[model samples]
Target: MTPSNILSVEAYFDLICPWCLIGKRHLETAIDLLARERPDVTVQLEWRSYPLIPATPPDGIPYRDFYVARLGSPQAVAVRQAQVIAAAREAGLTLALDRIETFPNTMLAHRLVRFVRTQDGAAAAATLVDNLFTRYFMRGANIGDGHVLREALAECGIQSPLEQGASVQHDMDWLPPLNGPDDPPPRAGLGVPHFIFNGTHSVSGSRPPEALLEAMLRALARAKQIATRAVA
Candidate 1:
């Protein structure tokens, strides 16, 4: 397989978002399908940090109350959660939304991902990402807490002390600053759980595995075309 056969999938997500977890599941399934169908193609998955609710306090706030306030009422929150739950269920994942207490400030969590990626490698960082998501969404753990983050890091076989302070912020230097209230929205203005294929095709939101798979295939084709053009 040539370099052109490698498909890069960049996923922008926030750990606190249930949809990001569901999106991760879909992306995984899509990769599996691509592997089965295109044995010669290699998919490189990169997870980017996109904090959906950056304004949340460093210590975080009550999860239920946060949603209730944002969505207007308890009934509205329930309806929205139910919709997300149904989507997650379809993806073969379960989200314990009701059990979550803190909405959490995900800066530390995202920085931890970058730290693990730098020290251990992308694969280790991916494992840590999965662990963090599970801890928060499934186990209702507060990922914002340094203690919880350290535990999650240890679970991923990372024994080094958790990086903190100004250094943690520097870990995110590779990407642009998080969107501010006044800044124009991100690509497509679709927010977290956004997927970019080979930096060419982008799909926003938690789309189905099939749709993601299609995007991967299209990206691979475009890569091949570009490679051919270069040779010509």
Candidate 2:
């Protein structure tokens, strides 16, 4: 397919969400599978912003309390968390549930991702996601902390823009315009980890690699049909 007819997917998510991380891993597997199946198909990925706890303080809150509050019943919450841990392990990811001390604001991390998107593209954003997940879920680091963020970014080969804030902004346009109360959310009527395929269809949550590949193929077909109709 031509570059114009290629499929594009924009994934909206936050680093704090375990399901989001699982979804990302599945998506990566799907991409690899698709590349092998259809060498002609080109997929463009864009990572968009979705903060799970926008109101979360910079210092963060204890994970146990957070889950108990959100899930209501302590027993049910434990069961659900166990499932998440197992799922993460199955996906070749280590999730240390007990070690997580706090859940912090992901706004700045999202901003950092947006910045990385401008400078190094989607791959960089993916790396940031992976790093943040590992840090928070496995290493039990406070992601909302600037020091931790800087360290993670450096590990991912992304220079800390905050250190040299002014120069970095000029070079990468890292500063995003503030969204007012009236401003709409990133994607219209879409939830966390929502994947918009080639501006045609939307897929939400963590889906199997087979499902993702099917959606990608459908998106590619849709693009071709649109191109043909335009010519006619």
Candidate 3:
């Protein structure tokens, strides 16, 4: 089997999830590694929306208590926060948990992402996704609000209405074919930081860049084998 160009990676994530942002950073690093190691392979990164707190209001829920309740106790949440901070540090990112006040419904943001992708392309969508995460996690902006979504898009050079025509409803009506019927379920259930490589292999969670890089290479090899078989 001979490896070729055009390796596609699709990521399912939520802007509100700190771990998801960490995953983004890790994936970015892995892509850089891919570029250096396999110059012939073109890595196509596609972002998919997977809202974590979809039912929260546009304004949002209180940040601290939301985690306290979700993780069982203040101590548990503190531990989680500490863990996130440590992981974020490795990826050269900060969670800024203290400044954040909202646990927002991210449907509007997803709509904006789709609109940007429709108008511009995958690169634009990736930029918007990064902005959404930065606005939510670093600067503590409420991404659920239409205004904030618009601001993020503006930062990304994508001009679009955040709310006027966009539905606040669930945006994932048509899912990407990252997984197929013949293959085993890649996950136990839906989880953010789900990464599928070349539409043939996948790995979930905010794994380190090394693991992701390995997965990407493996997917490429599998793709090459399949391509060779087809030709033969």
Error of 3 at 37 (Å): 1.2
Name the regions of candidate 3 deviating beyond 4 angstroms: 1-3, 162-188
- Best TM-score among the predictions, by candidate number: 1
The Cα local distance difference test for each model comes to 0.82, 0.78, 0.79
lDDT of 1 by residue, 7-54 (tens): 888888889888899999999999999999998987888777787777
Q: Write the per-residue lDDT of candidate 2 for residues 17-80, one digit (tens) a residue.
A: 8888888888889889988888777788877778866899767888788888998989978899
If both were scored by lDDT, which would come out higher, candidate 1 or candidate 3?
1
- Top-down lDDT ranking: 1, 3, 2
Residue 220 lDDT in model 2? 80
Q: Which digits, one per residue and each the tens of the lDDT, describe model 3 over residues 1-232?
A: 1445778888988788888999999999999998999888888887877666667876678888788889999999989889999989988997788888888877767766766776789999999888888888889888877667656766787765433454333343442222234223334467888999988888889999999999999998888888889989
CA RMSD, predictions in order: 4.4, 3.9, 4.4
Better of 2 and 3 by TM-score: 2
| Candidate 2, residue 101: how far the Cα is off, in Å | 0.3
- Of 1 and 2, the candidate ahead on TM-score is 1
